[model samples]
Target: MLSLLPQRILRLLEFIGFSGNRRFGLSQLREGASNHSLRSILCAFTLLFYNTYVSLILGTGEGNLAEAEALLEPYQEKYPKGSIILFYSARITSLRGNLEKARARYEECISSQQEWKQIHHLCYWELMWNHSFQQEWQQAYRYADLLCRESRWSKAIYVYQKAAILSMMSAEELERTGEDLGALFRQVEGLKQRLAGKSIPMEKFAVRKSRRYKASNPVPLVIPALEMMYVWNGFSIVGKRADLTESLLVTIEKVEQQLQNDPNPTEYHPDDSCLVQMLKGLCLKYLGRFLQAELCFSEVLSSEGRIRYDHYLVPFTLYELGLLQKQQGDFIKATTYIERAKTNYKDYSMESRLHFRIHAALNSLKGSPVSTP
Candidate 1:
C-alpha cells in the first residue's frame, strides 16, 4: 500500500525516513496469496483490490484484470456463493465492461447473505454506477438513495450523488419523483465529516459545488452525475461500450444546447460550458472521433481564463487530453501534457487523485506492464 502512494507523497515520506518497494511488496502479497494459509484469502483480496480498483481509479486504467481473475478463480470455486467473492467477481466483470453481467452478479452478491449489510451497501454503490453507465437514471437513483439512507460510509458523497443523479432526470420525471433538487444539494455540506484530522477531498469538492444550490434562485448543476462519473473514471469503463459512450455524448450535447440557450447566464456559465466540453471530449475520444475530441479538449483549455469556480477543470482536462494523445500513439506529446497537468497545477479539487493518475501514466510511458492479455 505504501508503495502505491503517489510519487510526490512518496517523496514526502522519504524525507521522513520512510520508503517502499513496489515490486517487493507485490511479491510478498503474491506469495501469501499462493500459500494455503489462514490469511490466504486476505492476501488474495489485497492483490485483487490493487489490481481491480486501485489501478483503475488512481492509475491509467491499466489494471491487470487477468491476474485478478486468476487469483479469484480457485477461491470462487471453493466458495461459489461467498458474498465477498461474488462482490469482487462482479467488480472484475464491471471493469471488463460487462455491465449487465456485473449488475446481475452484484444483485446475487447482495442476496447471497444478510449477515453483513455492509457487503450489500457495496453492491448498492456498484449497482448505482452500473445503472448510471447505461443512463438508467431512475434505477441509478434508487441505489444512490439506498446508500444515502442506510450506508454509514460518506453520507455527504451519497447525498450529493443522489442529488446529482436527480439532476440528470427530465423535468417531468424529476417533478414526478417530487424531489427538491436544490434542497438535496443544500444537504451535502451539513452531512460532511472529517476523517483522520483531514477533510475528505471529494466531500470538500461536493460541498464547494453545493454552494450553488444555497442561493434563493439556484443555478442547477449541468449533468452533475455525469460529472461525478468523470471524477470516478466511469468514462473509461463506459467507453468500452460504444452504445453507452454515444448515448453519453447525446446527453452531453443536449445539455450543451440548453446551456447555450440560457438567456440569463451566470458567472458559472463559462465553467459549466468547459465542463461539458471536457466530458464531450472524453465521449468523442472513446467513439473514435479523434479530430473532434481533440477540438473539444482544446476548446476547454482555450476558455481557461473565463472559468471562475472550477479551476480544477483546466488541469484535469489537460490530463484527459494527454490520455487522448496517448491513445493515438503520440507518447512524447502525451507525456508533455500529462507532466504539465502534474507539475503546473496545485490546490485543485482532487489534486491528489490526478497526481496518482499522472504517476501511473508516467510509469506506463516508461513501459510498465500494467495490463494483462
Candidate 2:
C-alpha cells in the first residue's frame, strides 16, 4: 500500500528512466507486511496480487508457481478457511495444472464467503476454466452462463465465452443451453464497453469474431472455446498436462475428419479448415508431435491465398510456427518467423497478446536481440 502511486506519476517516472524496480517494490511490500499496523494486510494483499495474477498476465504463463505457493503458505496455515487465501491458493494450483485441486479450493472459497457475491464470481470464473481445460464443454458453459447472467465484471466477455463454450458442444448438448449462439453473438457488439474512450481490444476482438455469424449463411466456428483459450494464453497452463493436450488433439482430429467428409463446401470452407488446422497444430506442438504440428501450421500458410474471411489466421499461424521452431531449437528459423508475424500483422484479433508472446520468444532466443517486428 505504501508503494502505491498514481498512474500518471508512475508513467512520468518511467519516462524519465526511473523504470520499475522489482527489488524496491518487493522491499516496500515486505516492510509494510512486517509492520505492526492496520495496513499490514493490505501490503500482503498487494504482494499476493502480483504473484498470483499480475505476473501471469504480463509475462509468459510459465509463472513462478513455487514463489506464489510460498507466499500463500503462511497465510494458508494462519487463515485455514480464509476466502482470500483459498482463492490465491486455488489460482496457483490452477496455473500449475492441478485442475482437481484448484476446483476443490475454489469451491471451498465459494462456501467460505456469502456476504460478497464478487468472490463467488471469481471462483466461478476459475471453475469454468478448470472444466474447459478438462474439455467438459457443458460444465464450462454452465459457469460462463452464470457469469453472463450474474457478474458485472465484463458482460462482453462472459456472453461471448458462454456462446463459445456452447459452440464446442454437440447439437443435443447445445440445445440444453436453450440459447441461440447467433443471438448471443449479436449481443456482443452492444455489450462492448470502452476504457479511457477506446473500446477494449479484447472486446473489439470478440465483436469482430461475432461478425462471422452476422452473415445470412453463417458458417459455424470450429472449437471456439479452445480458440479463446489460445487467445487468453490458457495453452500455457494446459501444456503442463499431457492428458489435457491429448484430449484437445482428439477434439481437433474429430473436427478435421468431419470437415473432410463434408459433401457441400461453403465460401468460408478454406478459412474454417485452416483455423482447425492451426488449432490442431497447437495441440500437436504441446504433445511434442513436432513434425505433424509443423505440417499443420505449414498448411495454413500454404492456404493463405484461399482464405476469404478471418484475415488474422495467417499471422497467428506464423506466430505458432515460430514457437514450434523455437521448441525444436531452431533459433534462427524461429526468430525469422516470429519477426515476420510481429511485423506483418496489424489490427488483428488479440494483436497485443500475440506481441507479448512473440516478444517473450524473441527475447529468449540466443544471440542478437530480436528486432521490433
| Leading candidate by TM-score | 1
Native-referenced Cα lDDT, model 1: 0.91
Which stretches in model 2 have alpha-carbon errors above 4 Å? Answer: 1-51, 366-373
In the range 1-373, model 1's lDDT, one tens digit per residue, is 7766788789899899988787888899999999999878889999999998888888878888999999999989999999999999999999999999999999999999998999999999999999999999999999999999999899999999999999989899999888998889999999989989999999999999999999988888889999999999999899999999999999999999989999999989999999999999999999999999999999999998999999999999999888887888887778889999988889989998888888888867776233322
Q: After best superposition, candidate 1 residue 148: deviation in angstroms?
A: 0.9
Deviation in angstroms for 311 in model 1?
A: 0.4
Give the runs in model 1 whose Cα sits over 4 Å from its true position.
367-373
RMSD of each: 2.7, 4.3
lDDT for each candidate structure? 0.91, 0.82
* Local accuracy of candidate 2 as per-residue lDDT tens digits, 1-373: 2112323445788888776555687888868877868877788777778766655554455556676676677778999899988999899889888999999999999999799899999999989999999989888988998999899888998999999999988889878778898999889999999888988888888888888788897877778888888877788789889999999889989988988889998887898899899989988888899999999999999999998877788998998898788777776788899899988878777666666656556655747434433
Work out the TM-score per prediction: 0.96, 0.87
